[model samples]
Target: MIACGEKRLSQKRKRPNILFAIADDQSFPYSSAYGTSGINTPAFDKVANAGVLFNQAFVAAPQCSPSRAAILTGRNIWELEEAGTHGSYFPKKFTVFTDLLEDVGFEIGYTGKPWGPGDYSKAGWTRNPVGPEFNRKKLTEVPADGIHKTDYFGNFVEFYNQKGNDDPFFFWFGCHEPHRVYEDGSGLKSGKLLTEVDVPDFLPDNKLIQSDIADYAVEIEWFDQHLGKMISFLEEQGELENTIIVVTADNGMPFPAAKANLMEYGTHVPLAICWPAKFKGKRITDDLVSLIDLAPTFLEIAEVENVPQMTGESLKDILFSDSQSKINAVREFVLTGRERHTHARPDNLGYPSRAIRTSDYLYVKNFKPERWPAGDPVPESAKQIIPAEGFKELWPGYQDIDPSPSKMHLLHEKDSLSRYFKLAFDKRPMEQLYDIKKDPACINNIANDSTYATIKKELRDLLESELKKQGDPRVLGFGEIFDSYPRTSKMREFKGFNKRGKYNPKFTQKDQQIIE
Candidate 1:
């Protein structure tokens, strides 16, 4: 849904101030513009109206660190070396988008989360992980309210107001919301009614799910409120129609079949771009766009001639066509994968999986499908966040093990579901393919069914071909290659907080390995 002549427009005018916004745990379900899910997102809706709404947008990785890293560096996880997954050990080789833009005379800075593990002082960073090695403004400044952090937008307003808006600016504001550690009914408390909510089939249809969804919506709306304020600030500064605004998230919600999985719920996210005075408004297109493609699009827009060694194609064709009838899609296909989720198990227990999603179906190849699809099945005491520091105690727990009969009885009633829960939580299979039309919730597995043999074969070939393009060491026959990748952080292991007292899982890698 890109506007026509984006490149031509870029070649003619001064570079627009880029305002890139990212939200945490946001999916397509939350945006009213998408209409697939029920949620009121006016701020997002406004942007979609003013610019292009990509109906099908995918993230490079599902988890926070890797996905955000991919977006910032314009490279895939494997290409980023040690910083390939969540809590990963990053090395000095990779450079982020902000760094490159700043080098080309743009004033760049990002607020909120950037997702690189150790900012330069830590093991893996060579340059300042986010931007230039040091802040040119003030390094040792503190706010009067005991909050020493400099806000992203407030700083931008200050910088441009003093400079008379002559210099181009690049600002990244990442939001930390809708990711849980949630207080149930907080949405209700904030005047949001659970009765008005619509529960997706993937979640159990009950008061619990409704309330949870409302709480999530509340957080997302709050994030939107912040984004709205940023937009307002731009208008007051007389830079409203000049800034190229991109609104999206890091990944999907933290839940079963999502967050860490290769499912659509894991990799699919909401993407909207708004640039007034640049394009037509109130248009939505079904072009499949990868978040990875934005890097190249940004490079092309800024007239930054060189392209990094990235796997994505620039979205030049998706935008304005000299021919009115030739409407090419933003992307032909999208790719996503994951290496590891948590440290609950050792041998660096990884649910190494890859996926290929077209407009219709999603195909996945699980290399270490022998590992738990959800998490390791251990004692009730094993499912708690023990040594949580600051705000990192928000990871999803072993939810399948909840002893309450409301869910427990329901779990027992469905034989395959019960086993699948154990399997989803414990380990997985080598191959998986889902017919999105019949099973949007993805509760059924038709990978080995004789009736779906053709579907399976087609998916297998697609998976192998894409993996080959990326030079995946697995299909080349080194299935255990991922195990050699270092587990940089043990954030999920020693820390857990559940119904029981302070629980610390002191298990070894060998103890948690799934039996093949």
Candidate 2:
């Protein structure tokens, strides 16, 4: 018979550890756990089966830096000022949750990609906003085509070992998978069949596109494989049950009309959380959740005081509740937006956009509709703006769109495949709306349609009101300040000249012949 003292000791609870595993540029419906067939993600599946799988999880923004900033601060993109735009500085005033966790005796560390593509030091941050780095470990056998070969599993083991057995910890495993610049034929080499690839409607169905997607699958598998190893390590240490494991991605798949766009694929991310000590397993919820909610959720779980600046609500109620029904009916809509994605445009201006997504509809407001939606049509060559010779050379006009087989195909067949090309790269209207249920691809614009006018107005009003309440500078009539923010990355030169030796026109006007 167990002693009373031993039983009391066994029943004692410790603060929950946090394991945040975020994939770079991965989208929902890509992981096999989410019913995607081409990719296999046993790790994500394990977490889903062991806890709650969120069918509708979204990021605050569609770009990397801003999306991650929102996840770290639990605030909207526009609220972040310089940090709100891509490749800009992270201001120190915006205290990250990790810093808060670290102050309260949490052993926090991160490996691989944390908060980046921007300078954190410029903001006087001593370390990366996520946490101190732990990427010294290396991998032996990794795909040559993949991005970083940081031994994420090994580094995590090191981090775990450094923490005492009784210490509560927070580890960020940011995998740089499935981003881009994939090795050609890596997927085929890995035995990923082309037929198994599920191509999105926006892109043409062809061998080249299939192969590209297969390569993406290979990278995603790599991320999952590492995650499985980490889970195994946690289970071995008997820390699995008490740990809060959150698996998701920063944004959507890196492709044309995705990634940087506030479209369905761009913002909708796969999410699964496991905390065996507090919640029942095998439950699925359609409750709309924002990635920003994660910051407050972590603070609440740790019994830490939430910062007043955090606008996102905690998901603790939804996560801990036994019921499978919608945890909060108020969580019906999620807001996602985007600023500069890359220094692809002239003067490093970003195509500012904001969007609101409900169960049935998606409403997007392109603030600078006259500007090239994708990117400047002509490449700012060596700081010299060039004239368009022919459509062939200038196929992928919008430099914001990542160079891919599908992108090239669209560019090559833009004349013949006008509709598809337009859907991916053409200039968009000021207001765009889509009935997501009928058109998940977001190809159909119903903003001007008489049938959706009511829905559009409702969503638009809600989105703008929220922006105002949040003090978004864009809506506060200081929107031009976002364009004026200095880009930390190398500036692409295109602001100096036009064909007639006239100073290059600001990209906001629709009359700019360079873009037209």
Candidate 3:
């Protein structure tokens, strides 16, 4: 009787390890698993094949810092005051899943980029919110110019070595690839044919754009390469099946109109979660999901009691269920918004906007519709010159959009490609709606069309109602509070900025301290 009781106790389920791999600035449908041409992502495809491939996964915000913050806190960007904007301070008051896991006997560490371009120390945290660093590994040389030399797999090995034999672990592998400022011809240099790349409708379909896209593919491949190596290492260690592998991107591609804007290419990102020991494999789910759900999902798996007040719901049911269809029916839509991205607008303002995306439609509400959706025009208010040397002048406005070869092409050939340029950098209406089933590119705005008036109003009402429920200051008539949040990034000199009468002296001053 005693032997039988001991055997029963020993058979209790062991907690699983977690491997969360996130790519920086990658779009949905860009991975080879999604049948996107030119880019090859075997590691991402492997994970998807092993578990479930989420067909509709979106981030809470399109920008990097806020999007990452949302993922870390299991809350919407608007709910996270300072952390909601790019390069703002992270308040330590909000609980993170990593910290919770660490307290519960899990060894947590992260390699490469974590929640950043922002300061967590200002919030009084001892280390990065993700975990302690495992970024000491460095590569002697990189395949391309723009790629980071941080050996992500080597660092993971370092983190793994430090863990106790019986300890369950959580690792964050953040890849800072597929972002911007790529080597001009690295794609061709990598033997990728230009014909393999397909330019999106929003951009001009020419050699320049196709080559740019191909270059972007190269970086994505680099990110996938490291992920493959990590997976192989785990398999060799006989720990592959017991680990929950979560692969996704922080936001979207760093193209002219994709990264910062609340379009399909902006918030929509690739997601694949795998856990062979528990969840069934080869299931592709088409349900709409958000990255904000990640924190709650992690906490649920860890079995941590006293979960905080998080806005996002857990995906445990969807993961455990074998159904390919919607397991959680309440997740009918996901909300995305932006407060500030870069110091682009006058007075260091941001283009405040909120949007809600469903499976069939995307509705946007631009609170400050008159403001430029991209950024202010080039040639600073103080001076104006075409920059005799070239089109690649430093700080050549539209600062919201990252500086890229595609952006320079649009600016230079604005006359010939006026439609594309305007689409990339233009003021939008107060309300915009797109039938995503028909126009996935979001080129046609049917919000004003009488035929779809009823659907438009329904979406608009739903969006505002949800935002209000989340206590979003934008919808609460306290929208200006976001602008007052101190921006920790480099301030750009734009029209009406730093002017005596126009702007506040405190905001204009350089190196403003965190407002506790």
Candidate 4:
């Protein structure tokens, strides 16, 4: 909550500094502000308590690279050609808000991760779209296992020192923690009890799964720790109240059926914005919002004109409004989708799908229903092959879902956890409808249920119409165009790739050259 009397900055002051802190692979309701157990996020809670806490925030896509790309360009994934997919080139034609800000007077730079596992170099970009890199700072003593050694806050301080005396700064504090490769039992070792873990219904409610989640909490706390330090640094520099701070994640937590799926757990993420001198504090809004809206918001706040082609609307109305809940009644629905994530499927094919999420329901359309949602069941190379460099070793089968302890447990104990495994890795139908109020986990599909036939039809029509309007190639009868994008990451050989015969030399040869 805000203080009884808060100080406001002068209206004639220089442009507001933008400190955007984004966590990797974090899900909604995972912070202490949401009353979630096991994880402690004082930094996130402080921002939410001091500003606007969004209850229904979702990303443009479920995966990291594409989702970050959407946020940078303020456009839907389908609208961004190769940048729409993970581990692909970002076309040079796309204009990022950061570049626009830099063309003005803002001093821009980023620490930790910024806009890739993909190559912006191949896309003919000289620097990261977010800004210049400021990751030169490093920690002398590493804090914990699985936590990156990069000193995120220290880099921010370095960037601050390099800024001009009269120039406003925009820094991207991207944290690499909480993505994956967590140290086992790290949370338990950090004094968190297993009972504190609230296991999602989709996963087995057992000690192994609980511990895996606890370990995830450990990484999340690490990310928050750096954020708290950053906030304090800005305050110490007398720039806290003047900076427009936005805290959120690129996508949901990395887990089976979560990070890579279009389900609520995958697309929904935590969002909090604080500008004590501007936006009202201690407010929580449930209106559906997409991450793509953030780019335009930043541009509008910076007073940048001649904006690029973008699909997202600016959040100035909702942000500056005094009303807490439903500031913009017209902002009812948000759309999310995904293409390729990892080199899992045959010929690097992706599970393409899109969804329309409203307050009460989520309707998804799986364009390639014949393909596996997670990945193919068999690998053409070997039953036990190590993944590419810097990536965790993925066990054979269901490679779209990252390698994790929960994944291993389910696969090893498939007989007992068959239902859960199917929910995570099995093929899905062409259309799926879920009542969010009743089924938050999305375990039951009611697409074919006659009782909700009208709702399903209405949702389908709305989803298709909106997607078509957005110029999504999937609905425009050339959905195969998505498969043509070259993946810059490692390629996997699945068992039936040759038999399926979907591979095309026009794209595959170019992709092979990039990969090699």
- Identify the leading candidate in terms of lDDT: 3
Clashing residue pairs found in predicted model 4:
none
Least well predicted 10-residue stretch by lDDT in candidate 2: 496-505
What is each predicted model's overall lDDT from 0 to 1? Answer: 0.64, 0.83, 0.87, 0.85
Worst 10 residues of 4 by lDDT: 3-12
Q: Output the lDDT of residue 85, model 1.
A: 60
Off by over 4 Å in 3: 1-13, 379-383, 387-394, 495-516
Error of 4 at 336 (Å): 0.6
Q: Candidate 1's residue-wise lDDT over 448-467, tens digit each?
A: 78988887787778778877
lDDT of 2 by residue, 47-151 (tens): 988899999899998888899999999998988877788877788888889998887668999999999788888568888999888999997778755557799
**RMSD to the native, candidate 1?**
8.1
- Model 3 lowest lDDT segment of ten: 498-507
Scored by lDDT, model 4 comes in at: 0.85
The Cα error of candidate 1 at residue 159, in Å, is 5.6
- Count steric clashes of candidate 2: 0
Give candidate 2 regions above 4 Å deviation. 1-13, 379-396, 496-516
TM-score of 1: 0.80
